[model samples]
Target: MKVIQVMFDTLKRNALNAYEASDIQTPNFDRLQQKTVQFNQFFAGSLPCMPARRDMQTGRYNFLHRGWGPMEPFDDSMPELLKQNGIYTHLVTDHKHYWRDGGATYHPRYSSYELIRGQEGDSWKAKVDKDMNIDGLDNIPDEFKQRKIGSIAQDLYNREHMPKEEDHMLYRTVEAGMEFLRENKDADNWFLQIECFDPHEPFFVPEKYLNMYGVSQEEFNGWLMYSHDDYTSEKADQLKNFYKALVTMCDAYLGKVLDFMDEHNMWEDTMLIVNTDHGLLLGEHDWWGKNIMPVYNEIANIPFFIWYPDLGIQNESRNQLAQNIDVPATILEFFDIEIPEFMKGKSLRKVVESPGEVNHEAILFGYFGSNMNVADQEYIYMRAPMPGKEDYLYEYTLSPMRMNRRFTPEELQGAELDNSFAFTKGVSTLKMQTSDFMGKNYQRFGNKLFNYKEDPAQKSPLTDAEKEFEMIEKLKRLMEENEAPETLYTYYGLDQIHSVEDVRKEHEVLDREQEAVTEEITFVNYHVKDGYLTLINALKDKTKAQAMKQHVQETKAAVTEDDIRNWIKDNVDKEEQARLFYQLDMTLRVD
Candidate 1:
């Protein structure tokens, strides 16, 4: 039997809901859903695209690598295993990150792979221009350039004027998949992975789909405004409508692929699985995009579906907590292959045969970058580090009333003490004021407990009680069993350096040089006029002053006296004393 996995990027479960609620229809997906076993409780192992894709391909927890960028050289991914097993693996995607040199290692593991470029708005521009029969001109107006950039406005204009022809990436990807399916109908067993890069950022949909939802240009632009603060109730509704339209557009394409599969009778033998890497937040919790906050269910709880024509587990829904890590093991098990010992996920085939029999108690999630949200099922925890500092832990109940509302220090201190939260016991560190010493925020070992059954939305923290001890103990055991050793290969510093001695020598040289360099001195003078302290750069250059003003505007903070002094110290080698004086003058004006 052939296995075809069609993965859509950022396809939210709510998108399906919205399509059903509105006049916009997805006949293909709807029919496929009827024949497939829908998994309602599938969650993402990691987030923001790449990490989740790694989890799906590696069959391991993302935290094992500390949420680092791209795939490491030591990563034992599934595509390699599939290739070794003679399962002709292929990947067709437009995810820009996968094209990065450091990130392309995973792509090579596949027997065959294709990358479709043109992110932002340019993806549709070439096709639109070609369809419109536009001449090759040396220059174009800003308005025309903006349209070519794939802006929402330009897409609307295309629907009215050009209407996408046969040149869209979406159309190309679908056609390629359909053609492959037809050619491989009776060939050797294979695995085809098709990734669609749509319904992501810079939301744009054809007018055909927009018309189904009755969305207008005013409503679409108004929805864009809701991405930030100053949102209104009316604006929120319009944004919701616009987002719904985009989902419908995606669904329309999904239908096309499904119809092709059905026409070729591919579903009879193919193990068809439809799922997304992650989700998007459209005005949920006052946020419009993915990375601004934690992995709420709106984004984390993804849509997972599998269809096996010969299997009896059709038209069923399971709520057992499953994640992307299980995907590799599931595929392997389907082919009667043994799962590797290092794999972190169990085969879902058993659970599918005996629904409600599996006991998956808790799932762990972690975020590594600027936005961090770690949680189980009951309570959500956050750690937002100050610029150039270690993160401080903040606990919160997941209810809308408590989200983003700071907990008083007294309240945190007064909570009943218990061993519900895990604490990292093995670690020693010399604290540094600046995060530069550690390179990034140091990981703190801690434990968190949640009552998922009672509060699936994670609205409240578990209270300390004798009855909850078992649950806490089980969670700790799971965490310990799943934890993987961190090797030097995974560390950001070690990964960059050629050898251990190189890393040590680089640091040692810097440490020795630090003692001989003398600190530089500078001053800023502020004048009070009309009850306002106006600061001016003593070394005056109108252009430099304007540049500094622009910098302040962009960073949303004035260049303070300390900032200027640091700038001078860092760049003194380039301009000597002149750099110090100019920076000092700029500092006074910023203050």
Candidate 2:
């Protein structure tokens, strides 16, 4: 038995014709629709990029304990499990995050892997002109102008290195996967993951695909890569068109794989899975990007398709809710390997074998320290953190690394060694205190209750108190089932009675005492210390310094250019700025 999984990044579910009406035509996805079972209610468990990937690889949600970090020592990675069970696993990906600190532990789990770089700000090419100026780029905010210019310039530099369309990172990644299949077609009991970071950002594609989308070459605007932006409707439409063209490019590449399967008659033996980590927000809910806003239908609800040729399951649609966590469990079950006790996800193969079989009553998902969201096939509830209670969050992880760097000394200053969880393999881990740098964006959007049957757009928050309570109960139950920390219940203002029993009991008396003493205890007035301010000023990276400056300015604090200049000179050399910027950019993307 063999399996081929093609995972596309930032693929909007509605972009495919089989999924919804879209200006972009994804015929290859439509073709796959006929050959596989499409999961309509499939949602994202963890958020953004690497967190979602973590959920896929480990079959467990990581957002509850950690924000964004590498695979823990105790993680049960399906590929590693398969490799141990005498099954060959190969991974080919253009997703550069795998090289970062948070994602570094993932790709190494495979028996063999290949990486193709130059997706977005990869620093792949050496001769990029950072000072390249873009003239007449109107309505670009001053803060975003430099970033926009850097992205365009780096893309221009990278494009110069790729003389042919086939040399593009996505093309190379897919080609590598196809090459592997061509070389090892006769081999049995192997799993191949062909993941591409295309249709993600930069929206870079050959002019031919743009033509297919009826978008002229001159009108080709690069992907709006901002994490948050307010755009004019015209500019938003242009960005959407560019995204459509890139999606068309993805379709063409997918068609190539379909052709390969047809030529080889591989469908008779190999199982094929095509899915995305999560969808992108293209001007949905008046938002231009993800992570900065609530994970609505446009982002949390993702596209999931799987084909098991050996089981004769094809051309079907399953409404039972599933998520990214199920992928690993499905793969493990397909190979007859026992699912790890640590995995909270159910095997998707059971659904394939028995259609419409419900595996979960509700699924929990969100960014760490952000909203704790839950969906029960009827309503989506985003539970807000209690007011003035954001500081209760702690990141429990065996790996102290963030996206591209180690946790700062200050971050780990009050770290505690904890092994309370059953899944931690009885090994204590550093429970680092999560601060503003970890994820200060929590509670920004507030809580929302969206009824899928009535308000699919989630335009208005539902006010049914009973229904909300029911969803909250579901959320509490699922969190406990996943071994959520006791602090999480306190964060939500929920009673500790129904939480993880041992942890709840440990904290119950303390919680009552703390509540009683809250009025008597004098709280220190929070203010930005001079040392912390100096640290922000000492950010040698231009982007990070700008980010800190923007954040400080938003706080209405007085900071000047001279102060920034003096700090830059004192911290790090100018040559190291770009490297630090890349790392900080990756780290802050999660934050």
Candidate 3:
């Protein structure tokens, strides 16, 4: 069987006319919808670029264990499995992340692959345009100037070389894919993945597409300018139009693929799957981009369509709730290969053949160290870490490479072998603390529950206590099924269903365990000694001691001179409260 999977990056569900009404035209997507089974409730299992791709390949979620990392050594990659089954797997993509430190392991799994450069911040060009000045570009903070300027400069160089619309990276990528299809159309036992990085960021499309939308050259910038500053409505509209123009260009590429299939009549034999990694946030919910905000429907719910030739299903819409994880399992089923026991995804063949079939109860998705979210088609629940509990998370992976750099010495200092999950194939691997790499807001969105039926935009957070409790319990059960780490449960303050520590001990590094215990004791002893020092320091500062006494009697305001003054005036018996206040002052300082 031959299959072609068209993976588009950051393609929103509402971009096509078949999905939702928009000023942007996607006639090709609409045309493909007629010949394919469109999925109505497809969500992204993991987030951003690489993590989502990992889920697509492994048929399991990646965010639960790691964020933005490469394929693990133990990953049951779909392409590799297909190769082992005597099927040729080829990949064509402009997603440059595949060449980075963390993504280097994925493309090698394929039988053959082609990477098209000059997408986003990809450093494909060296010439720095010293004279080009974009409007409002200087408003970017100085701290971000180097990276942003480098991207802008590289993009300027890339655009300079492409004089024609056909010379664009998206067009070239599609052309390469078409060439591959034309050459291998009659070949047996081959799968082709035509991955496009268009319509992602920097939404740079050809002038012809911009002309179709009546967007002038000067009005369009080749940068998305993912700034934290609030955007005016007019500016947001302009940015949206730019993205729409790029989508139109991407639609034309899809049309070219359809044209190839029609001309060759390949539809009778080839299975075609069209889907996006995840949706992009275009100023929705005040989010300028993805990864740093809540995984709302605008960003999490994605577009997915499939055409199975043997099944002979066409122009139908399926509402069976699916995710990116299902793609790998579906591919494995198409090739008649045995799905691995570690896979957590269900094959979409069942759901496609029978739309009424329920494939999943709840879909879990999130970025690492962010809110852990679950959705049941009607309601979406986001469980955030308790305040200051974000540190209680760890990343267990054999591969310690980061996005663009190797793990630092500090990051690996406490790393040790661990086999806390059943899917690890009885192999102990490096378990590193997430706090070593994940900084504050590592893509954080606080706890929230939303009923999409009422608030499709997810603007209003629901306060139903009973509903929240039910969702929390469901999330905990799912996490347990996924074999999530103990720290994950502790981080969210969820009741542990099983002892993850026992699982760790089953494959323990005895020396590391003892060292961990020793470190805990040392930490406690240091704190005790620090408390005495703080008390001595408090005794030496009578002004501070008096202020602390006054602070205890005042209204509950954080430490401030005004609050202390108010307490001093209100207290008539200062001597009686002095000792208690001194201890309180020492405790506050020590903590």
Summed backbone clashes in each candidate are 6, 0, 0
Tens-place lDDT digits, model 1, residues 1-591: 678888877787866842234444655567767778888777777665766776787776654334334554445567777788878888877665566532555688889887765443333333434343222211232333335333444444433433363554565666677677777878867888877777665455555666676766544532142122334787666666666666666677778767776788777788888888888776665556664444567777789888765675677787777778889888887766677766777777766777766635656554433333333434433322222233322221211111113334544443332222111122221111111111221221112234545755544544443323343344335546665222212321222335435544644654454322211211132311100111122223556445543433354343355554453455334334343342233222221
Candidate 1, position 345, lDDT: 75
Q: Highest TM-score: give the candidate number.
A: 3
lDDT of each: 0.54, 0.77, 0.77
Off by over 4 Å in 3: 128-144, 436-445, 496-591
Q: Distance (Å) between predicted and true CA of 429, model 2?
A: 0.6
| TM-score per candidate | 0.63, 0.82, 0.82
Rank by TM-score, descending? Answer: 3, 2, 1
Please, what are the lDDT tens digits per residue for candidate 3 over residues 314-372? 99998878999999999999989999999999899989998779999888998887788
Query: How many Å off is the CA of 255 in candidate 3?
Result: 0.5
Ranking by lDDT: 3, 2, 1
* RMSD to truth, every model: 15.1, 8.8, 11.2
Candidate 2: lDDT of 549? Answer: 49
Off by over 4 Å in 1: 18-24, 121-165, 216-229, 369-476, 484-591
